[model samples]
Target: MVEAAQQPKRRKRIAMVHPKFPPSFWSFGFIKEIGGFKTVMPPLGLATLAALTPDEYDVVIVDENVEDIDFEINADLIVLSSMAIQEERMFEVADEFRRRGYFVCMGGPICNVLPGRCRPHCDVLFEGEGEYTWKQFLTEWEKGEHADNYVQEEKVDLRDTPPPRIDLLQTSAYRVGCIQTTRGCPFNCEFCDIIVTYGRKVRAKPIENVIKELQAWADAGVDFVTIADDNLVGDRVYAKKMLKAVGDWNRARRYPLAFYVEMSVDAARDVEFLELIRHANVVETFLGIESPRSEQLKETKKFQNAATPLLDAVKIIQSYGVVIAAGMIVGFDNDDVGIFEDQYTFLQMAGIPIAMLGILQAIPRTPLYERIEKAGRLRSAAQGNNTLSVTNIEPLKMTYEELVTGYRNLFVRSYTLDAIGERWLNNVKQWGSKRDVPPFPGKKPEDPNPADEPNRKWIQKPLGRPRIHLIFATLLILKYYFAGGKEKRNFALKMMWGTLKLQPAAFMQTMNYLAYFIHLREYAEKVVARDEKFNYVFDDKNLTAESLGEDGHINMVKNERSKKTKINVNDAYDGAEVTADIAADLEAVQAR
Candidate 1:
């Protein structure tokens, strides 16, 4: 531990920055556009950290996704939290702060896993859960005895976790507010780093504490809340208690809050639990159906997923009126050439329209990374965007090129106009037919009442209708009708008719899916184009070089040598061109 020197005691101005995320399938910007928000979600981690800060400290949060970072702001210390995708920008921001003589501290998953990469840029580094360590650091800082590195040796008690200072957020900027009820997952998937970071033992906040946080959001008039847990039902007993509390809390309010969560497939096994989740008004659940192939599940040690048939489990959940957004991965050791077709077929068969497909990545600190490193198959650090046609490890059965091509092909086939429409229709049909019993005392307004006769006027009025969402839905339906062929036009017409007729309450959900498809279709094409352009870089047989042609264009040479490679600079390669600055940098590298 490197301690800081004693200084005069005073109130500190802390600027916490949540780094910008690169646009990906998860960004969900289209949903934000339709839903009337700038970003898909706000920075919950930063908000929680701000809540942990002492009241004496003047704190300001800057989420780069929502607003510009004011570099000129006067601050005694700067703090940053980020994931792997934002690592490059985090380092850049940290270095900028350091250059300005600001005491910068960094934490979160990226800094924890790749400390060496972040250490040079930050004055203080925090590794692991900061619920306790952050307070300790602040105490030490006030005493002028803060350490350069503060790593938490013990897991945090979730009961002690404070409600996030959500007041610091610009609520209108985000489509959804976030609240975490639990931490860690029970399963030990070889490729997962959640256990490495948060540990395998599930720790949940008290039901009252969770409800208190939700009440804060409710008081703030935020309707959509994402329960940002790895698996909310990791402890079934605790989950039931939490769900019941949330359901009761939601029922008391005029505008009930809708929730979205991530959970394992095993949650579907318990019929009573499913009813509770439905009553809680959870709109969607992201399930990690990593692969349909059972062999791959066993090989990866994701045995919990294989406990039940994957398709049947998905159907069971959808049967409870919950939208299932699943994750699927290719390039597993047990996967072969046929895995692509198998995955595509399985998704369609399962009726999971919003399938996030990706090539398997060996994240650092995970068992998969260790195994791959031991096998000398590790190529590079994970890029963090799993949907990209890239991986850090050399696959076992397939070459790098094969994996990239196959993964890209899967995206194209899976997200095409026809495929998405077909899957959406199937999903809606299944969802509409589900007999979701309201676990609460009062029936949902959307649920048909047996005691009262159904009136046409009551049915015509859309339940919980947002005018903007309706407008977007109408436009999307028109786009589908005019732009598509007979089959697509018919599908669009059917969807529009079915949603309004059978499940008017689910109209928003239907629009959300269409919005996602619109973004995904475009993004998938971009991924394909990106892969084609960079495929040569990953080609082992090809020798690549950057050469400046006489036309002043940067030419990427592969396999064959170019005559224009020779230049006046001594540091230049035999057949490559180099500017004076680049030549000097190359000469310096040679000297080292």
Candidate 2:
């Protein structure tokens, strides 16, 4: 059993909650890859907060998205970090702990925007970046001068930020832990709230400081790390410097960790930037191809990504050898029925192995929110209460139901078992055909690991499968030998068979996604049910315009429906008058 200190030391207990992940059907190679959900890392914000907290405080990190918080552990303080999607559950947690006499404090993106909304449940509602604000709150709390609310000093530079307390993390639970090189994006996409939270001017930690953190992780024996920048390549000059710093550091250490990052399609313009990324041992980059249509892109003011040939761009990025995971949205104002088929065909043509098809929703404090409101399209500004199809504006071309149904159809068709199988089959075939392409120029051959050499024999190594390769090779040669011009079919079949032999585990994972498809069908039906409910109370003429106030957000509302139900004219009737009614009923029964 764990021990508690005498006098309790007024020990502060903190619990950090991560936002629920949106459903991802195509993320992990279309199957339950072995290190699949290992991508779910500890919350870096809370970890940094812990690093900043006083050493006297007892910090117990609970990542609710991955593990349960132990309520049985008696605590004097409970701190929570959350985002918009998790505000409801975060409130529930706060309420439960408050009832148990614990001081609950809240912070992160959701609380930062709507402090007054979360003020009721929390003792300290910390708005803005938690690095400085959290320390201030703790100092006051320790001195017994705690307030009902605490807002962080705005525009705190992130360069001097402390490294997160990695000792608090469950290292084995992830393929990699997260580290941020920069905060904020340069682009002003209307739908994005990143700039609102982090500001448009990007703040990057110094390359030396970033290297120190990576070195610390490597010393701790962590093998995988994600540079969790909202936009890693937003500024190519900084990206080059940072990527080179990481690559140089890793090269000295003989390349210890594999990295992943998120960036825009504009990174394609910088060839040197791409080379640095490749040299850095970056495995994957998530590209936001929000929509394929130029009109939709312009409507959303995602002009940085507009007018580009998506298939050609994807192929160009792929030729650099880094895997691409594209993000696609379907509920833009210009979207129509044809978009469903267009998106599917686009993915197929681009050779994109994974695409995230999502519905558009109005996020808080975004330019989109202001613009939509001005257009008299604010659906409900109830903030955290918004769910699927809670966008303020009507989808201009398609009805709400049509949009919802179209999204469902797109997801269904794109993630179908047969489609997934065929995609994998095609991906393997394409990659295999290009296997003869020479290794990337200027990339150093991976040096051997000295420490690994000692323990190498004890570690299970791959069994030689030369015979299997020969057998498959012979069959392929014969198939191509026989098939005249339809060698493409023969090649596809051979690759499918080779993929099964070479990566049996990955192949099985692809097959397992068939089960996820079944679950998706059930989930889609629930979304349909919710959409049907919306149809009942919809105001066709104004759509969201009728519900919102002049300021263009439903910040407040009167509960007239509840007040009306509580009062009744029939309540004044006396019991003696009611007795005559009962007597009539008895007489009727007697006659019967």
Residue 32 displacement (Å), model 1: 4.1
Q: Write the per-residue lDDT of candidate 1 for residues 428-502, one digit (tens) a residue.
A: 555543442222122245434311212211111111225566576557646755586786566566666767665
TM-score of 2: 0.72
Across residues 372-411, which tens digit of lDDT does each residue of candidate 2 receive?
7788766544333222434445677777656655565665
Query: In TM-score terms, which candidate is top?
Result: 1
List the candidate 2 regions with Cα displacement exceeding 4 Å. Answer: 1-39, 219-221, 381-392, 421-495, 498-592
Provide TM-scores for the models.
0.82, 0.72
Leading candidate by lDDT:
1
- What's the lDDT for candidate 1? 0.71
lDDT values for all models: 0.71, 0.59
Candidate 1 residue-wise lDDT at 130: 89
